[model samples]
Target: MHGIEIAVSTVIFALRDDPRNDCTALGMPLVRRVRQPYEGSWALPGGPVRPDEDLTDTARRTLVETTALSPTYLEQLYTFGHVDRASKPVPGPRVISVVYWALVRPEEAERGIEDDNVAWHAADHPPELAFDHATIVDYALWRLRTKMEYSRIAQAFLGETFTLAQLRQVYEVVLQRTLDPANFRRQVESSGGVEPTGEYLVGGRHRPPKLYRHRAASDLADNGPLTRL
Candidate 1:
């Protein structure tokens, strides 16, 4: 079944909601397909895998070709193989698609949107997608929300030196809920994913919020399971 195979793709995100503190909401680069099947329709930036390429490399290449973005944090999200994942009237397989999710800094990703039709949409909301992408998007969003609750994912979506208020916004956008400032700050401190850099923001109107940075990947426990629910 080598000829009848599928490939992996990613839904990469970067936070861009920081005008107040120079932060920005989370954004994902989307492409308007130029070829057939779903031509002119919007889709996640990705493509088929070459015979010799590894899946992750394929995902990365597709990201470059479609969106010009580099993924700072990439991981396999899930496999989607519904019977009609594709809409080809011709010949195509069952169209099994391995989905991945990635995160990058917003400033770095802004340069990735090349096409006039290609645009950065909020990671929380997007236009009507092609094929079974809607379902894939739902699954990816669920994974992101659940994983952020128990994993060190907040850093992947934020800058190294971020204020507590900025970090809270990441949770708010992804979880689609407002978090109490006191509770969120306490929880982040207790989780140990971030540590203060002995700096305070001075420009904001209210009390200066402390600045913190994300922990390096090596700091987290990597021996066994990586879930926290």
Candidate 2:
């Protein structure tokens, strides 16, 4: 047995053009490890937690250092620390990772650095990953889809103003299902999570669609009681 080491990793989700589907799909960035235990394998962006640095700040820093992305919506997801989690013959102290998940707007996501070492992959069908990152990504996807059912978190993927159709598309792409346009519109309007911007989208051939934005006073999503602390 050896001393425990704390680390921070982030799963950043974004909507990107899925050439396979010719539409927007959920994607995430992975950085190729330059050193073993799994050198050359892609893994979530992260690093050893520096002394005196907060967990959230460390999570943000890892994203910037690896991917150059700074998403606005970030939340602590869960901690992963199993004695056998990395049972492979690795020469290092046991690592316990505090994981976070984030959502980024399309424009912001496009700015992420994508070189040979860092690249975006389709979240649902990601390639081989190092350690237990595959499991971590599954958990993050579950949490995101669960929250989308009852929260305005979907707005995190859109611009400040969007049409109802645009908002619904986000849910559909993430949830992997189709939502009734009428029902979705009615629910969103009644949910008090968004407000009309009093402006309509231009450049469309059909009648302009009224633009809406998340209510300024509302949090993207209800984070439970811990948010109050």
Candidate 3:
């Protein structure tokens, strides 16, 4: 009897300019496979987990090797081990995939483009993926949008100091909706998720906007059990 094969994958998201729409969109990098079972198809960056490494380490190493990325916010998203998930014929034990999700700033994400067979695709409209990666991306997106409503996860997409408008844009892009400036400001202040940095963003048409930084991680909304890892 064949033993189960363990694998690791990661969905690393960043806000990037989508030339197709000429707007910034949430996207992640995908690598095109060269071998069969789903050759030439785009999929998340990952590979088989080594026995000597932990799951998280495997996820991190695969991401860096495939896209040269080191995400600022990395957390375990889910484990998928359906009996029929892999395209390979049965009789062999199922393949188990431990999926992780991460967030990185746009500038940092660009560095990943240097890798071969890797390219960024908008998360909301990814191409057909190999295996069940399409479903995995959708689930990762759901977790991201849901987390934005409560936690300061959005901060991972921005620099150390950012204006309220900039922060609001991150939400608008992920949530796919516009927000009232006054209301968003009030809500964020009341939530104490951010604090003024005593700095301001200049060079825009309007008055300079004050910049803010995220509160300490411990003070932010709980990210469930992953925060303790």
Candidate 4:
């Protein structure tokens, strides 16, 4: 029996606040492969796991090396080990990918564009990706959308202190719909996921909205069984 080759991949998402577009949209960086199997194809940033490093560490390292991004939120997404997942036909061993999803600020995502091989693409409508990366990104987006309903994961996309409008924009972008500002504010306040920072965003055309920050982790809803991991 052949041993399975383990690898790590990360789907790093950022909310691009485009002035022309009313709502922000999710974007992620994809790297163009320079080697065989899927040479010149766009794919998630990843690498084979080292024998000594833990899976999460490998995920972080691969992300940094490929995109130079250190996301504020990183979590194990899912594992894919399908027999035909690899683009190349290898006779030795099947490959298994431990995928992770990360959330970084828009500025960080923009900085990553310095790499010619790495470019940000819309998460909802990415071009054809190598291997099973397209499917992996879709699943990761689904996870993010679902988690936004309960967990305070949306805060990860924002800075330390942000206006309610900015916070709501994160939700609108990820959820792919406009939320009723009044109702959305009520729901979030009732959930106790955020608290006012006694600050305000000034100098905007509109009235200054109060700045808020996510509450302590314990105050947020538990992400079911996965939270422990």
Candidate 5:
């Protein structure tokens, strides 16, 4: 009889600003595994699949189980299966894993997860991760960066009805570079991703700033896209 093992893992990404880029660039979260074969080591959230469960079902279930976080955007990223990955266990077959990329809203992130030990690190400077997780994260981020440049995915980083400045922050963080405000605003207008509310808020230390909400359809479509992060 042939036997196979399946597991689901997640690469959860959030927007974070770092001073290295002059308060630019964002990062993701990587949790430490408490199990053997990599016990007390850092890795993405993952768990073995139970019988009769689908690949994504395992990923979603594992996310809540480990992080107490329900990902707002969840999509299958990739599948990894290589020789010697499970050579330790005698008679054990190849272990195949399906990794997912998920994005969490800023508020949801601030609310945070139940696991206090989970540490959120900058994506550009990730720690030594267990197994092949570093490679996994790299791929996921590349996909996000590529998609963001052309698509309006960067809007996911902001709240409803945000100012041009807020939208620019998302790009700066993800790209790890400063965006020309004029060029950014021009591009945003052409994309039709946001519309001005003709309303301004005056709570900051400076003058009131204009606000705009990301189009509703764009938000919904984000939930539908199969992404790695």
Candidate 6:
């Protein structure tokens, strides 16, 4: 009788230029399978879980080995283990995948490997993927968009300090909507989630804009007790 096999996968998002529109958009790296059930199809960066490694470690290792990415914001997303999740013409045992979602700044995203097998693609409009990866990608994107509304998760896409306009762009790109500059600035200021860094960004053609940083009291995401993790 076939037994269950455990694996780990990651959905890593980054803000980059959308090749389709030439505007900032969410993208993720995918690896093409070289063999077996879904050979030659794009899939998430992942591999089997090692006996000595925990789920998160396996997720991180696979990311580095497959795409050369090591995101700072990594969290357990969800588990997928439907009985038919791995069904195929080729013989294979049942697979239980523990999925993790990660966010990386654009600079970090550039570290990913781009080649015949690994490449970045628009996360919102991924190509035909192997297995149920399309479903998994949709779920991860939904979670990120939902959390972007009420959490400071947007900061994950930016650096240490940024102007209100820069921060708003992150929101616009991820949320896929334009926000009024004046209204957005007012709302962000009133939220108390960010504080002025008392520094101005120089070298811009227009007047320098004040830089702001995420407040220490506010965590990236409200993961309850897991906030410390």
In model 6, pairs of residues that clash are none
Work out the TM-score per prediction. 0.84, 0.93, 0.91, 0.90, 0.84, 0.93
2 against 5, candidate with superior lDDT: 2
lDDT of each: 0.76, 0.89, 0.86, 0.84, 0.77, 0.88
1-229 per-residue lDDT for model 4 (tens digits): 4777899999999997555766467988899988767778899999999989999999999988888899889888899999878845433457899998899977786564678898888899998888889899989999999988767888888888888788888998888888999998898889887899998887865768888988766323244786676
Residue range 37-85, candidate 2, lDDT tens digits? 8889999999989998999999989888888888869999999998756
Against the true structure, whose TM-score is highest? 2
What tens digits encode model 1's per-residue C-alpha lDDT throughout 12-125?
778775456664566777888787777888888777778899887889888877777776687778888766567455445666788888888756875556579788876667
**Top lDDT model:** 2
Error of 3 at 130 (Å): 0.3
Candidate ranking under lDDT, highest first, comes to 2, 6, 3, 4, 5, 1
Per residue, candidate 6 scores C-alpha lDDT tens digits across 1-229 of 5689999999989988756767888889999999978999999999999999988899999988988877868888999999888876566789999999988888888665767799999898899999899999999989998998888898888888889998999889888899999999999989998999999987855878999998988767567986665
**Candidate 2 vs candidate 6: which has greater lDDT?**
2
Clash statistics: count for each candidate:
8, 0, 0, 0, 4, 0
What CA RMSD would you report for each candidate? 4.0, 1.8, 2.2, 2.6, 3.7, 1.9
| TM-score leaderboard ranking | 2, 6, 3, 4, 5, 1
Worst 10 residues of 1 by lDDT: 220-229
Candidate 3 has a TM-score of 0.91
User: Where does candidate 2 stray beyond 4 Å?
Assistant: 89-91, 112-114, 224-229
